[model samples]
Target: MHTKDDWITTPVTADLLRGALDVERTEHGVLPHRLPARARAQCSDGQLAMAEAQPSGVRLVFRTRATVVELDALPTKRVYVGAPPRPDGVYDLLVDGRPAGRGSVPGGNTLTIDMTTGSFETRPGPPGTLRFDGLPVGTKDVEIWLPHNETTELVALRTDAPVEPAPDPGRRVWLHHGSSISHGSDAESPTTTWPALAASLGGVELINLGLGGSALLDPFTARALRDTPADLISLKIGINLVNADLMRMRAFTPAVHGFLDTIREGHPATPLLVVSPILCPIHEDTPGPSAPDFSGLGEGRLRFRAMGDPAERASGKLTLNAIREELARIVAQRAADDPNIHYADGRDLYGAADFAELPLPDQLHPDAAAHRRIGERFAELAFGAGGVFADSAPPA
Candidate 1:
């Protein structure tokens, strides 16, 4: 029941906001995963704190314009929401009181809504906020009906002013794709999701295609990216493949190529970055159930089993290391001709060193501090020094 003039602001404080990395014990003493020094300065201690800090549950937030004023041109609208494990739900979007799009937020970390179907033809100021930007655009009135026990908070709403019409013109867009890890799992806020963070840091318009539990290199996903508009593009793969044991080396290599090939059909020269997964122990050198034993689930206290038998490790199955090696080979071969294409191992953003210092709270997904670490690293590497997007970026 808030309005446009309310101006939601995340408070800041000097006290330390407990981070996800702070929840567990590690081999190298208690790891210290902290927010980027800059983030600490912006968010109040209370704002930095998580509402449901448990490791096994999912938390999401859905938001969009409450009213739209000017509608000279179709503005790019976005809705930001946080994530948790096993997030499954349906989000319906509407515009001008008509159904425009429909989508699902399967369980994972991050969820985003982008509204970009038809041109804007309404008046300005803020006409009842166009509904649901996190789902595919074309939706009219935004309404999200989620399953019970799933927690969500409407965080923020954003849109770009209509651009002046031009005869010979096109918009610069960024198309990014990745797995649940990229989807912002366990991150504290909508703006903190690594892709969102990177987009904010990079100062580029983005279509976040990060699907939780759905980055399995599906042909549908590749086609989605292929048809989407983008000036720059990136695809983060590997982690999900390893954890799910979806494909072997032979199938993986070809799948990666095919996925890229599909995208290339649409954005032939756009800068494309292929990112591998970040550090994850359960799938680092090991296959996964990635499952947790929540035998002791109390009212709000959920605990999980962290360690598994060594025999499981020796099974010679898919692991993060294995995925990284395969990705390297793929990029090495592809980069020769596609100079615009690039590769980034997930670890470079948050690898063994970071994990050694701050093991993931549940040994799978990163905590808030880890998210900050990943964000800072991504800002440095992906956006380059002195990037402006994440610096002055608004809340998601």
Candidate 2:
């Protein structure tokens, strides 16, 4: 015998007893083809029903059957090169068909995109997906131009939902810098980038400045980080520098210090985490192109060589071990003055032991499965219990 208010107020109550469980279910048949009408309808009338959008740049969203809203991120314009003569492929970007940007994928699988001018050049991108972002807030029509070899397929589009202005300021920001592995290379979607994954898990807003080939201790990048706003910061170094053979011990040592010193200029007391490169065979003790072979025929058929002898690393090259040793020494020296600074060996997130079990298919970038493993490990080590980062709190 309970009053109406009593029944409603019960904290741990059974809905069945109250007859409030009028469960209703409906199964909508899947629709095949690009730009499903329903999705397009949601985008019509210059209205969008989405979580977020960028008024002036490309916004990427990743979804899968397991998780409908899998991941999303605004594309970072910074690009990098892996090998020379970068591959040549179609550069397709359409904003109502006026040509927002254009570039061809070169041979090295490199990418160079100019955000300000809306231009791009990169090697052939991974296949089987298409995305567009940066539409004017009230776009009603969209025309696309495809690469010579590609066909434009409208996969999906949605107008962003209006965002309510927040009354309170957001939490302290965390800025991170890293390589392709951090740039979501081979990640199932743009949002699955390890940094993004970790950020979501940590509940911190992020400024991911992961430039693929460009992470090699560049002065400009250091300057950029120094100028940016951040309360917590991190730099995932080593692999790219090793693979690119960008500098030797003579220059590498100073460059590392310079990068850190530059960031400290802006964040004198902010917590900074320096992450070593994760386990990458091609660049781990072994010089790059660790193993290479040729098969098939024609110009596009011959594969480049890689994976040389690990013992040869003694010849003044940047290897993972070399970077690790140097980073440890550098951090130890700096830690004396900068107590807020921290160091995290990338292997702590994904180590040689894990590599033995889950080798990167390309011997460079981790595949999708590896990305998940790395993401989980990163979330645990960099953002888990007793971790240095305190910016991210579990969502309420």
Candidate 3:
């Protein structure tokens, strides 16, 4: 058991956090928000609200000389009505940009969701503590990456020594938005998410707006992107739009245009890359709303199956292939007028051949290994020499 006999308790302040746009003070502690309160208030979907608050790319970053560190947190774990119990959320610690330690705060709140009825119930619980020991002596950059999927409210920070907000590394800020894949779904930890890894590889500071099941090209999200400061930007689209069956081509075309227009209003010359969906066999040609496959629920496994027919495509119903083609065309057309805009086929990140080796376990999102591959591919394609985003990239 960890105690605070000789420890110094420090309040977790907004200045100590990175990649969070805003934060809400909660009874347990501080709840980080990827989307600002204004954007959150414009929407009513509980799913989107929850996704934006999960802290996919957020972390507690500071400089400290402490060898022992403890973080008190309240993590809200999501529990599906029929799925297996989730493991405790993992908090990854990095010292001077190297992985130093990892820990998890056990026993927090639970949010139970019934997919069949689209209903959810939240049960409150007390905060738990995470302790990490054996840090290198002397002042070192410390980063405690919050859990990617769990909604965590930080209560307090206790260390053997004092800490200060870390100095900015002067890396170019890269703001990205996407679906669960970018939100770190199926990722091993927060930092291993595709966007996070890609940001590290690209030598960019990341502000991820990747909300799971909520990247429907909302006006507020576009406005958030418009207002956020970024040297580079990207959007991994199509997956959530198709899986949600949210819109047809009629709505998608203008939605894409409007989203770009809004962001360009603030960053007209910024390098903006529009990425289409990666390979998903079920949704490659078939349209969605995807349905849950409860056949394996008894074995604590759940899967997804596309419910829309291929015939729907003739009627402009969205599919991965259609979305990819349309996105490519849109980017090409926009690039003629906006030289900084570009396009990348998501297939380049994870396609059929790659899928053969690293399959999507739930028939939708990529697993941890696939996330690495996607991140690596994205880094090479977006930040490598001559890549679209390489003009101002950090020295390799």
**Pick by TM-score: which candidate is best?**
3
User: CA lDDT of each candidate?
Assistant: 0.50, 0.52, 0.92
Candidate 2, residues 111-214, lDDT tens digits: the string is 46343344666454322323334445542333222221111112222223321112222645667777767755656543455765676577665566665544
TM agreement with the true structure for every prediction: 0.55, 0.58, 0.97
Assess the local accuracy of residue 323 in candidate 1 as a C-alpha lDDT between 0 and 100: 74
lDDT string, candidate 3, 1-396, tens digits: 335687788899999999999989988789999999999999999989899999999999999999998999999998888778888888999999999988899888999988879899999888999999989989999999999999999999999998899999998999999999999998999999999999999988999999999999999999999999998999988999999999999999999999999999999998899999999999999999999898897677779999999998999999999999999999999988998888999999999998899989989989999999999999999999888889554322
What clash count does candidate 2 reach? 23
Best-to-worst TM-score order: 3, 2, 1
> Which ranking of candidates, highest lDDT first?
3, 2, 1
Off by over 4 Å in 1: 1-172, 299-316, 385-396
* TM-score of predicted structure 1: 0.55
* Model 1 superposed RMSD (Cα): 17.5
After the best TM-score superposition of candidate 1, give how far the Cα of residue 390 lies from its true spot, in angstroms: 13
Candidate 1 lDDT, tens digit per residue, 1-396? 335455333211111111111222322112121222232344343212221122111112123333332111111122222212333333333343234454443223332321123122322222122233343333122322211112222222333221111121133455667765665666654445666566556665445555555567877567667766666777889776765566666677788999999989987876777888887766666665354434332222233332334355355455677778878888889878876777788888888789988777666677778878887777677667532122322222
Candidate 2: TM-score? Answer: 0.58
